[model samples]
Target: MRRVTVQYFDGCPNWKVLDERLRDLAGEHDLAIDHRRVETPEEAERVGFRGSPTLLIDDVDPFATGDEPVGLACRVYLTDDGPQGSPTVEQLRAVLA
Candidate 1:
């Protein structure tokens, strides 16, 4: 089974949406979803959390650009249309695939 972790801060509203989308994707892939809530900046730094709704596949953030500022804040994903709070389903599917 593939291990997936979604690290997020409580302040971000998009976390739940990301979680739900990931759950759907996991269901299709027969993967288990692990949700981790990072409540502090220290914890975020300890876990290398980039921002809210960070998806980690096998302990690696596949979508991370490595240049994102590490802190407690909302994350923006660049999509074909524009910047989105949460990545589109197609983006998620492509990453998971």
Candidate 2:
């Protein structure tokens, strides 16, 4: 089965948005999703977390461009509504599809 892992830190407001969308999509696809909290800089470095609410599909970050600085910060996605904390449902659908 494909694995979807969402990496986020505590108190990140945007994680919930992505989490809910992911859960809904996972249900539709019969996939599994995992939520991981990056609590420290060390863990972030070890896991190569680009930012809070980082989504990994089968251990690979599909949204990353290979230049994002790894840290415990809020990640932004460029959408039709301008920059947002989480990707749009359509965008997520394209990536997850």
Candidate 3:
């Protein structure tokens, strides 16, 4: 089975939305989801966490570039509409697909 991990800080409001979308995506793919919450910069660095609502597929961050900052902060996704906190359902589906 493929593993999906969503790492987020407590302050991020978009994690729930991401979680819901991921759940739906996982259901479609018959995959299980794993959620991780990171509270400190040390933990973030240790996990290579880029920001709140960071989605990892099999431990690989699909949206991250090697130069992206890693820490406890808000994450932005480049959606068709514009940069947003949470990725759209279509975007999520594309990633999971």
Computed on alpha carbons, the lDDT of every model, listed in order, comes to 0.86, 0.88, 0.85
TM-score of each: 0.93, 0.92, 0.91
Q: Weakest 10 consecutive residues, lDDT, candidate 1?
A: 22-31
Which runs of model 2 end up more than 4 angstroms from their true locations? none
Writing each residue's lDDT as its tens digit, candidate 3 over 1-97 gives: 6788888889998888899888877768776788899988999899888887998888888888777798988988889899989889998777778
2 versus 3: better TM-score goes to: 2
Model 1 over residues 1-97: C-alpha lDDT tens digits? Answer: 7878888888998888888898888777777889899999998888888898888889988878888988898888898989888888899888788
Better of 1 and 2 by lDDT: 2
Model 1 quality (TM-score): 0.93
Q: Provide the RMSD of all predictions against the true structure, rounded to 1 decimal.
A: 1.0, 1.1, 1.2
What does candidate 2's lDDT look like per residue over 11-56, in tens digits? 6889999999887787666668899999999999998999978999
lDDT for model 1 comes to 0.86
Candidate 3 matches the true fold with a TM-score of 0.91
For model 2, which pairs clash? none
Which residue runs of candidate 3 sit more than 4 Å off their true CA positions?
Answer: none
